[model samples]
Target: MGYLICILLYIAGIIIYGIVMGKKKVKTSDDFVVAGRQLPFMILIGTLLASWCGGGGITGSASVVYLYGPVVGTLHFAGAPIGMLLLYFISSKVRSSTKITVPEVFAARYGDGASIIAVICIMLAYVGLCATQIKAAGNIISLITGMDANLATVLSAVGILLLTVSGGMISVAYTDAVSALLMVGGFLLAIPLLIGRAGGWSEAMAAIPAERLTGTGGLGVIAILGYMIPTISLLLGDQNMMQRFASAKSAEEAKKSNLGLFAAEITVCVLIILMCTIGIALFPSLDVPSNIIFSLAVNYLPFVLGAIVLVACVAFIVTTADSYLLSAATNVTYDVWGKYLNKNADDKQKIHFMRITILVLTVLAVVLTLFFPTILSLQMTAYTMYGAAITPALLFALFSKKVTKAGGIAGILTGGVVTVVWTMVLNSPYGIASAIVAVPAAVVVILLVSALTGFKGEETYRRLYENSKS
Candidate 1:
């Protein structure tokens, strides 16, 4: 009953906040989509941290750390911070652009054809990513409330849709900021308590399999790299990340936010690994590894602390779902419907269309959750699909003057196609991750094709370079 009250109160506060912000701030499409490009440094950093560390980081990473050990799990989770560190160098460039969606950025460089492919690839990946959050949310709720899993999933999807539709980026970003604080504080407080509960750090270490303490955790090097690449690739070109950068008050603020995110992300990553390691010690016989953190919250911690951490986890999942859902909806509203269908959509029309897209996509995500067996599996597949398909081409277009239109199109098509075929058609042949094959394949196609096509002088690259200089 205490857990239920905390969770419900948290949800209600978020919803009410969304409603209040939507009415006051979301007056125009810009306000709805990017918070009118006025996000301060702290909020931007918080949203970036919260959004990225969602179900994938919480439930998914917890599962991995429980199965493997701290060493292997830490390496597996290193991709995001590494990617954020790299992104810091280019975040200024990303923020300087006026585009709202990644597809818009692509369309500027490679034309409408490339944008269309980007839309397809982004939608595929983001919807799957959104589904993972919904699935995680359901799992958390079911574990806490003893509700039916499927019904909980449907309720989770509805809550995310409501929050997203309420104020778009305004509500999402602000809620993300709040969520970030709660998440960090809750986890930080729980760590020492959890460590003490597990009979201190050394005793906890003695409780687990010795092999789990090894560097590889008995998993192959290839598999570890496979797990790492999708996250790095996704972070490098994730539309959600780009949108947060775009939302910053200035290019400098965007760059600074990355630095903050890196620090926070590293802190959270270490905490997750430690907490899950403690979980392994306490619950070695548990059937489902994904439940490690939640189980710890319920069984290990004191009631109030457990409720707080659980609420924080819920906030993470909800914010991530809405952020991705809103980003995917942006692709449809700006790239597809506004660009091709209406071409002259007013602010009201665009916002309306985006809200509708949110509803439609939420339903799609709920259906997608049925296909994947676990949050980690779904998370990797979505990450690989988007990372392989869009990251190489987008990065090349942004950083290289040699990239050609034909090359960009070919790269997007090849990367996306290879990821789909490798994962779905071939069952990830030999259990190798699609990213290992697909990312390199995309990069090669972009270089080889661009070389053949010859430099055509990318106007977008030239423009962005001039902007950076000025």
Candidate 2:
């Protein structure tokens, strides 16, 4: 009952924060979608850190490390920080393009067909990511109250939807800032308590299997690549990160935030790895190893400290779910609806459409969560699909001037189609990640098609690209 109260208080607090943030002056679609493009470096860093250190980080990575051992699993969490560091080079470029979403970038560089395809890929990837967060929320709720998992899922979804529907990115950014502080503090305080309760690091290490302690964790090189590459790929072109970059107040702040984000992400990765490693050691025989981190926070720590960590976990899940939902819905509103359905729609109309889209998306995410077998599998599938399908075209379009429209469109189609077929139709082809095949395939098609076309639009695109950089 005490645990339930703590969770309720946290939910109530987010509700209040959402309502307050939503009241901020919002008169334009730009404001709703990108926080009026006025977010400073600090807020940008918070939201970026909060959004990425989410379901995939907490439950999904924890589950992988717990089951397969930390060596291979750490790579899953490590890729994001590495990606952040790499992003430092491009963050200013992304912001300088003055695009609200990756699709906007696509449409600007590649054309409407490419933009539409990018939207499809974003929807496929982000909705699954939103669903993963919902799954983590449900798992957290069920672990604490022993509630029916379905009921918990519905309740968690409603809470997330409520907060998200209120104020798009404006609310998301502010609340995510608060969530970042809570999450970092909660984890910092909880890990030591957990370590102490688990009978110290030495005992915990003894409880873990000898083989699990090795760097390879008994997994093959190919298997580790499967984990590492997709995460790196997703980070390179993640729409949520791109959207946050677009929201920055200036190009310098946009680039600078990556440095802070990299630092925060490194801190989060180490903490999660430690907590999860300790969790697996303490609860080796639990039925659901994925929930080990949450379980340790709830069942092993002191009640007040446990409650803080639980709320922190909730913040992680909710912030991520809402961020992805907003990103995907933004694509639908601007890239699809604003582009095709209502090209002349005003700010008010677009905002209304975005809210309705959020509701619709929440429902879709709920369904996906109910069907997916595990959060880790779903998370990886979503990451690989986006990374393979979209990142190749995105990176090529952003960095290279020689890419032709024909080549760009073909690359988007091939990458997205191949990832879906590889995962859904062919069962991932010898257990390798779809990106291994899809990204290279997309890149090859892009190069071959562009070369055949003699870089048809190179001079024109180069001018536009140079202007964005300036």
lDDT of each: 0.91, 0.85
lDDT of 2 by residue, 242-359 (tens): 8898888878888899999999999888888888888878887778777888888877888888888888888888999999999999999998998899989999999899989999
Residue 91 displacement in candidate 2 (angstroms):
0.4
Tell me the TM-score of model 1: 0.98
TM-score, every prediction: 0.98, 0.97
RMSD of 2: 1.7
lDDT of 2: 0.85
- Assess the local accuracy of residue 116 in candidate 2 as a C-alpha lDDT between 0 and 100: 90
Candidate 1 worst ten-residue window by lDDT: 461-470
Candidate 1's C-alpha runs over 4 A off are 463-470
